[model samples]
Every structure is written in C-alpha cells, then in structure tokens.
Target: MRVVLDAMGGDNAPQVPVRGAVQAAKELGVEVILTGKRELIEDELSKYSYSGNLIKVVDAPESISMDEQPSKALKKKNSSVHVGMSLIKNKEADAFVSAGNTGAVMAISVFSLGRLKGVERPAISTVLPNLKGHTFLLDVGANVDCKPHHLLQFAVMGEAYAKYVLGDENPRIGLLNIGEEETKGNELTKEAYKLLKKASEKGLNFVGNAEGRDIYSGDFDVIVCDGFVGNVALKLSESLAKILAKILKEEIENHFISRLGAITLKPAIKSFKKRIDYAEWGGAPLLGVKAPVIISHGSSNAKAIKNAIKVACQFAESNLNSYIEKNIEKYG
Candidate 1:
C-alpha cells in the first residue's frame, strides 16, 4: 500500500514527518511517498541510515499555512496539501496523511476526493483512548453548524469506523447531550435522539444519550455530536490530560523521597502517559468521504506521523467506504 505524507504540514515540518515516513516504510513495510520540498526531504533522510528505498520524496514547492482559508489555498496547484490529496484522487496513493491546516485538508479532500454516495456532510472522526478501548467521536470540528440529519449521519459513519478500527462487532453508539434522557437536550439533540432510536431498530447499536461527564468513562464505543460541542469537548479533554500529567510530575518531584519513588514507578507512569497521549492514535480520520484522509495534530512528531500512516493504511484496507455506503439507509 502506498501512503502519502505531507512533509511540510506540521510544526516539526520536514524533519519529523520525513523521519516518520522512513520509520513507517521500514517497520510497517509500506511504501511512503513524502510530499514536500524534495531538497529538504533528502537532507532529512540523509541524517539517518534507513533499511529500504520504500520511502520516496515528491517535490511540492507551495504549502498551506494553518491560517490560510481552505478554499483559497486549494487554488494553489503546487501546494503540498493539494498535491498529497491529488495523489489519492488520482489513485496513485491509497491514503493521504497530513498534519497541516485542518481546514485546507478538509476543503481539498471534499473537493478532490468527493463525499460518499449518501453522505450529506463529511465529518472528522476522532478516536479517544478509553478503558474499554477507544471511543470514536464524530464531527470533531469539520462542520461547525449542523442539522439533525447531519448528526445522524455522523453516528452512522462513526459506527462504521468503530466497528472497522476498534474491532467491535456491534459497537455501542451514544448521542452527546446535556442529559441521558431522550426528552432532554435542545431541538437538535432531541431530533437526533429520535432518529438514532429509529435507526437502532434497523441495525445501529444506538444507546440513548451520553452526557459530557460520561465520555471518559468508556460507557460507549462511539459518541456522536455536532461539530460545535464535539470540538469543545475534544479540546477540553486534551487540555485536562495535559494539566493532570503536569500536576503529577510536579508532585512527584516535590521531595527527594518522592523523586526516588518516581524512578521506581517510571515504567508505570510512562505507560499511563502513552495511554493518555492523543498523539498515540496519530490523527483523526475524515470520514464519509470517498477516500481515506487523516488530519494529524499541528504539533505532531515523528512517531505521531508514523502512526497516522498506519491509521490511513488500516482504514484503506478495511474497505470502510463500501461499508458506509451499504449502511447509509439505516442512518438516513
């Protein structure tokens, strides 16, 4: 499988992404096409001794900045983000991974790759590591404003993703709301709940409403919400994890005895850190699209990029698009 990487997309840029591509190429045994300035990619590659020539560089002079509007940036034919998406559109690459501007990635993908047969709006599905496994949260920031139908579609697409990625036969899905009762929430949530309930009769594993507090409890495998709420919840959860980690580290270093204890508990702490790191999953998959596209964090590092490629590869191999299309009626 050929996985395309946007070399100049993230904060670390060519170095981290290039290193990741090389590592993925060697370990995952997948061909990686790095899209960026050819000279920079080669320079980075020369710094490390790699096993195979599975990692190739594609020259792309232009790049889309985080602040650039998606529509305006897509006009730049030579932009790295555009070039990378084009690879998927042209069938030259199985999937596209980028840590660049989220808007640019989404805009270019929707324009070039197009949406699935019955998808009204393509949503970004984020995987949150939980005790049971990972919870798939949809509309994580793709569309700020959404209709009830849009949310219902997100639920359907999210369910497909959870089943394929999380390996759940019938993943339990929840609608994010203020209260768990079907009668609670605004008009949108109320309508969405009803739609989901109707859908559950057919095939969807819809479990009533899921409040914000219950998200991290691993109560459900997938949580569906509008972009407005999903984005806020995602950011808050990420921030909370970071703050808690920092507090724990500071407390551990407060005393010499604690420091010694920290050393003894280092392995366990590291494991906990890995579990809470959002980067471990690499990036969020932009579902409901015709092809696989991953939007990585702007601050992603080498390991994150590598994992993002794995995510793309897995999605492509799972034939999720066909699954979503086949089950579109259940969601509609």
Candidate 2:
C-alpha cells in the first residue's frame, strides 16, 4: 500500500517524521511518500539506513504552524499537510497521515476529500485503552456543537470502527452522559438516545447511556458524544494518566521499602504505560471522510509516526469507506 505522510507536521518536524517514514517503508514493507520541504526531509532522511526506492519525497515549500488559523492556512496549496491530503484526493496515495494542526487537518481533509456519501459531518474517532480492551470515542474535537442526528451518525461510524478496526463482531454503542438513564443528558443526547434505539432495530448494538466513569471500565465498546464533551474527556484522561505515573514514582522514592517494591513491579508499570500511551495506538482516524486519513498527536515521536502509517495502511486495506457508506444508507 502507498501512504503519504507530512514530514513537517509534528513538534520534531522532519527529523521524527523522516525516521518514521523510513521505518514504515523498511519494517512495514509499504511505500511511503513524504511531503514537505524536500531539502529538509532529505537531510533528515540521509541519517537513516533503508532501501532507496521504498520511500519517496514530494516537495511542499510551505508549512502550516500550530498557531496559524486552520481555515486560513489551508489556503496555502503548497503546505505540507495540504499536499499530503491532496495526494489521496488525486488517487496517488491510498491514505494520508499527519501529526500537524488538528484543526487544519480536519478542515483540509473535508475541503479536499469531502465527506463520505450520506455522512453529514466527519468525526474524529480516538482509540482509548481500557481494562478489557479499548473503547472508541468519537467527535473528540471535531464538531463542538452538534445536533441530535449528528450524534446518531457518530454512533454508526464509531460502531463500524469498533467492529472492523478493533476486531469486534458486535460492538456496543453508548452515549456519553452524566447519568446512565435514558432520560439523562441535554436535549441533544436525549433525542440521540431515541435515534440510537431506532438504529438498534437495524442491527446496531445500541447500549444505554455511558457515564464518564464507564470510559475506561470497558463497559461499552463505542461511546458517542459531542466534540466539546469528548475533547474534555480525552484531555482529562491523558493528563490524569501522566499525573498518576508521576505520583507513583514520587511515592516509591519517599520510602526505601516502596522503592524496593517498585523494582519488583517495574515490568507491570511499563506495561501500564504502554496501555495508556497514545503512541501505542499511533493516531486517531477521522471517520466519515472520503479517504483514509490518520491524525497523530502534534508531539508524536518516530514510533508514533511509524505506527500511524501502519494504521493508515490498515484503514486503506479495510475498504472502510465502502462499508461506512453502505451503513449510513442503511439507516439514513
């Protein structure tokens, strides 16, 4: 499969992304097209050892920075992120991967690739690691304000990801709300609950409302919420994990006995970090788009970038767009 990557997207820019492209090409056995300032990307790439032909570089002179306005930056046709996305629209690449500005990525993707037929809005579905396995949360930061039907569509898309990508045969769908009752949440969620119930008739495994505490408990495989709530939940979960790790280390250092205990539990701690680390999942997919697009964290490292490409390859291979389009029509 051919994957196009924005070599200038992440915090470390060409360095990390270049290494990732090489890794994906060498280890994943896939063709990688890196779009960015050609000189810079090549300079970073020269430091790595890989097959000369597996990776290709496309020159995109401009780059959109994090602080720039997403809508405005998208106007730069030569920007690396925009160019990377365009590669998919032109059918030159199977998927696009970026660790750039989230807003710009979303905006450029919609403008370039458009939404899947019958999909009103494209939602960002993030894979959150949980005890049983993992949970797929949608609209993480895409549409802050949403209508009732939008949530229903998000549920449908989330369910598809859970089943196809996560390997769940029948994924349970839940609405993120304050209470588990059907009568809970604002007007939007309340109405969405009714729509989801209707969808269950068409084969959706619609579960009841999922409280915030249920997020990591793995009680539900897919959780639907507006971008505002989902973004807050995602950020809070990420911060809490970091803080908890720091607290654990501090507690261990406070006592010699605790330090000795930590040494015995070091293996467990590493496993725990791997479970919650965003790098492990690579990046989140922007569902409901015309083409497969993977968006990684802005602070992604080489491993994260490489894994994001792997995810892009998986997405392209799944033919997820065809299934999503059919599912939307089934319920539309």
Candidate 1 stretches with Cα past 4 Å from truth are 253-260
lDDT of 2 by residue, 29-55 (tens): 889999999999888888877756989
- lDDT for model 2 comes to 0.89
The lDDT of each candidate is 0.88, 0.89
Q: What are the RMSDs of all candidates, in order?
A: 1.5, 1.1
Q: Over the full model, what C-alpha lDDT does candidate 1 score relative to the true structure?
A: 0.88
- How many clashing residue pairs are found in candidate 2? 0
Q: Which stretches of candidate 2 lie over 4 Å from their true place?
A: none
Tell me the lDDT of model 2 at 71: 76
**lDDT of model 2 at position 240:** 92
For model 2 the local lDDT of residue 172 reads 88
lDDT of 1 at 169: 84
Best by TM-score, which number? Answer: 2
